[model samples]
Target: MPAQDHRAPPMPVVRLVVSDASHAYLDAVQRQIEQALLK
Candidate 1:
């Protein structure tokens, strides 16, 4: 219903910035997920 409502105002845009450490952690997690899927 909310999406169908044309009277609603536009939502604001969001930007995300991740640190180097966060990127490394995400890479490690992705590897873990891939290994689990292969098992």
Candidate 2:
């Protein structure tokens, strides 16, 4: 698996960083949409 590989390790780290950023962005957008709906 890519995660188990110790050599050439940048891929997993980059994937994690990108995933985290996207998740945070999506959460922020969801909150805004919810607020708009409630108003």
- Candidate 1 residue-wise lDDT, 1-39, digit = tens: 867564344322111234556788999999999999999
Q: Please write out the lDDT profile of model 2 over residues 1-39, one tens digit for every residue.
A: 775676568888899999999999999999999999999
Top-lDDT candidate index: 2
Best by TM-score: 2
Alpha-carbon runs more than 4 Å astray in model 1: 1-18
Estimate TM-scores for all models: 0.54, 0.79
lDDT of 2 at 17: 100
Model 2, poorest ten-residue lDDT window?
1-10
lDDT of 2 at 30: 100
